[model samples]
Target chain A: MKLRSQTRVILPYLGILAVYALLMAVGVPWLVRRGQLAAAETGAGFNPTSLVIYVVVISVVGLFAGLYVNLRADARQRHALNQLTQATRDLGEGRFKELEIPEDVGPLPETQALKGALESTAREIQYRMEAILKEQSMLSAVLSQMTDGLLIADDNGRVLLLNKMAEKLFMISQEKALGRSVVEVMRHHALVELWEKFRGGESKSITLEMGVNRNFLQVVGIRLDDEIPGRSMLLFQDLTQTHRLEIVRRDFISNISHELRTPMASLKALSETLLDGALEDPPAARRFVVRMDTEVDNLSQLVNELLELSRIESGRTNFDFQRVFPCGLMAKACERMTLQAERMGLSVGQECPDNLPQIFADPARISQVFINLIHNAIKFTPAGGKIQLSAWQDGGFVVFRVADTGVGIAQKDVSRIFERFYKADRARAGGGTGLGLSICKHMVEAHGGKIWAESEEGNGANFFFTIPVAST
Target chain B: MARLTLDRELRLVQDEILILGSLVEQAILNAVDALRRRDIAAAMEVQHNDRRINNKRFAIENRILILLATQSPMAHDLRLLAGMLEVITELERIGDYAKGIAKVCVRLAEEDTLIPIREITTMADKAISMLHRALDAFIAEDEAAARQIPLEDDEVDELYNLVYHKLIQTMINDPQAIDHANQILWVIHNLERTADRVTNICERIVFIHTGELMEMDSEDDESEDEDENLDTA
Candidate 1:
């Protein structure tokens, strides 16, 4: 039924025709000559035996030729069939090898058409495979380089894909995280809760803390369209630093209000007393006026300190870094605090090692630090208590300590004593504002130094600060 | 066609197990970080996410069951499925230990332990790295690498002992720190148990590769014996 088999029957007939023609040419001539001789001799037309021999020779030749031709055609068909089968299978698997039709086989149109279809199909598939590979690589490139953390999850909360940023933010590896549930990979309950809360189509945004860094991630989850079939995408933006700054800003405002209220209340009370006929008594009027002036001065000092703190914190404080004598700064600080010490009946002394190294600092700010520490020492120390200032070189910096024989800070309060507006003593017994130590900390830090306190309650307090020695 | 689907499903299960392993790894690191920072939020998060790890274990187990029932895999393929079935339990148990550490961190939320957590952190670092390498060996199917992974557990156990002794001394010196130090001791125990689970995973990797379930690392058993001796004394 095949083209090759049909040709097999026809080729044998062609071979038979060739053999018959040869026999006819030779036998007709020979028989004619023989007949002429017989007519001359005994009138015989042709030799029957010669005719039979010619017929037999022709039949044998035709049979062998037909068999050989048919066998060769069958071999060629088999070779072409193998080639076509292999090529088709390879093409289906996205391989594009050329079809190797056998060389001996003639132009078989059906097989040619099959080969053409395969080549074209292979070419089309190859092009599609390349395009898909390129698109996949491009997608992964985008995912890897994205800055914000991104995760795509299925309806069952299983993670389908995550970027490198998401991996880092969640402290998970992408190789291991994909196909796992997002809750397990992220390991943050707030995030899992956030996902659940937003999956219901109500809120799309929620903030949650995740990972070891407690990274505050602002997550927004959106349900993908039905085309993606129950998949959702989440975008995570880190907001830890922003949230901390916001809290700091809020506390700054509240602390400022509390600081201003005390002086305002005192001024109001003093003014009311003066206006309510306390002016008729001359001594009482003078006392009230002095009190009002002091309260006004306290308000002005609070405003100035607040401005200075903000300036230093904002990195806007100008620094004239210069080499200064440690002994001279100590003398200046002690001289400034002498009146306050005497008023409080406390003895103030300085003990600087004469060979102490010079420090690189903003001289005015450094002097302010010393003056503030001494003021605090004098205020907290009882009458006859001693306050000593000392300085010595420790490593790359010159360390200064203001040791006060005052009612010491509690063990717990020592850590927070240097914080802004934090008062160690709850009673309003000290005249100085609580901003002194905090101001000292900011100034010391600006000079590339450090500050801390050491104390045991009811024993003594020592506040230490260090300034880096000037580079030689 | 059935074989192709089986191969794909087997790969998916392998990936899921690695994901489960890394989840527990992250939980351990986060719990330790939270303890060091005194961060209650991170501690609580680790505790809350433990259930998700258990869920993933069940999912992986179900997939393994499905693969076995449908595909009827043999030899190494069978070993891989069975190994995965056992390994997920190890990963889940490790995750629970991490959650326990997180719970201890929450209990010590207010009180600061005088005992230094450095030794425990060192042990955690070793355990995490070991777990990481074990996962790598499992993925690569490297029997040699898997055999070499549990040798690092000796260092983790040593660090655990150091943390234990240091915590005991801290409690002895300051009786007030006894409650806090006891919580820290539990944390160290959790980290030690996590390292033990990593070794178990390594053994599973060897089993998946060779189909012979011989113990790959006997050092952990010896260390446990020694630890028991110390406890009794």
Candidate 2:
């Protein structure tokens, strides 16, 4: 190819030189003889020296012109080749800008055609490269933003891809986990078994619950036999919150059933006893009837308390918030419980400062909270023990306390006392429906306050609650 | 070519060890959970699953023996295979401990005494977590991590002590509860032993890295106390 191009450049110059040689060999000699003949005819001396010199000078000028033209043609070709080399270098370096081919390649058509082809090839590659990059970035963005964890592994169980959620779920870094075995990363036996099942064609997809205690994960594995042979994907969905809610719901159902059964059993036994023959004796019949009446009243109270608890829990119970003196609410609650406290040999006392800040709360609900606490205090306290009601302003709320000398709550059951139907060990024997503290919790929370208990078993119990101070 | 085959076979053995580790971990968790819920059926299931864990351990052991015979691994590889053998044994024993807890759960179901389930579950959590990290250190050949993991065993021991005293107090207060208290004590003893086994696994990890067989947590007196308690129970 190099020889052909070089020969093309020199061919025209060679043809010009050949024509000159032919003229010098044949035409020039003939012309010289004619000149000599003319000179002989004219009887003058025939001197051919000046004619030869003239022919040599013209041939030298023509040769210099051909050399100059060939040199200029070579320079243009070199310039075109340099441009093509630079474009190829830029393409290799990923700079896919337009190729700047000169308008002319010094009359070499093949060079011009090569330059055109290079330009079009760069454009095609640039277009395809941009499309691929766009798809890649989109895929990465989707993978990173996914809520569920995603992990893709090869047939050999080596991790090929993992998303941000997958990294978080396994507590592993992507760079470290990739190319590592899935079993090593997950560290769970069930997942390894799931992978084996997928490998053996036992199943296409499987879901299982993994993790211990409060943090539960539902893992879904799928074998990708068709899309990419011998690859698999895992999706991890965290089920901890759902599992906790299910537990709470189950506990509530069991507790509610246990609470209802005791009174129902008594009611059934009393009616059966009366039907068996207590009616023949009027006094005994009357006694059994009174017992049944008390049992019915207990059932009614339990039903009513359950309804009130549900209403408060669901935010269906409205609070008529009023600015009332804290002292007045304490006094009212003490007054309501004083008779019962005295009957049980416990003294009910109120210690609220008259100048304390008024609280924003439903007056009746706040009184009910106080009455419930005082009633609980009276029920648990021995004779001659004291039940004290105190209120003070703290921060933006009024803190109320009902302290009693009684068998206090156990350490473990302290946190759970506010759960409906949860009773302290002592409270179980000293009978009242176990919904009192749970109702108190909801009531105080509805007033935008907090409630808690501080106690030591066999010493005393102090129940505290807060209500927001009415803004002036 | 022989070197490549040995590397591949070693990886296969390591994978089997991990599978065995997970099975034992699951068993421990299920046993403690069954005790908490007083679910006799679940406890029986955990008991039944012990055979599977035993089979897995034997399978891994056979593979390691074959590797030792055929590959004749020297230096670090030999140490690794040997450490793996010890780890699987520890894992199998832990599985038996889980089965022991499950048996206690079954026995406790027949009695009316309330077991201190919260403390036992916490003990199980600590021990299983220690085992998990120990296995991770083994896989990564991390000597430093293996050294650090045994320190968590102290926490399990503390919980075990707390549960033991509480059960003793219960027995002293109510003589009728002595039988149930003994059963509960056995469960915690199993958990304490499981934690001890986790330390053993950690020791194996250190052995794999440094090629030295050394005890990590040498609380010989405490382990003796545990053994005495187990025998009395």
Give the number of the best model, judged by DockQ: 2
lDDT per residue (tens digit) for residues B1-233 in model 2: 98999998888788888888888988999998888888899899999999999999999899899989998999999999999999999999888888889998887776666777778888988898888888889999989999999999889999999989988998999998898898898899889888888888888888888878898887735655556456333
Q: Scored by Cα lDDT, where does model 2 land?
A: 0.85
Model 2 DockQ class? medium
Off by over 4 Å in 2: A1-108, A202-207, A426-430, B110-114, B220-233
Q: Give model 1's docking category.
A: incorrect
Per-prediction fnat? 0.08, 0.62
Q: Please report how far candidate 1 places residue A93 from its true position, in Å.
A: 3.8
Q: Could you say which candidate leads in lDDT?
A: 2
lDDT of 1 by residue, B65-173 (tens): 9889989999989988888888888888888888888888888877744435566677788888788778777777889988888888888888888878977887898
Residue A271 Cα positional deviation in candidate 1, in Å, after optimal superposition: 2.2
Worst 10 residues of 2 chain A by lDDT: A205-214
DockQ of 1: 0.09
Q: DockQ of each model against the real complex?
A: 0.09, 0.62
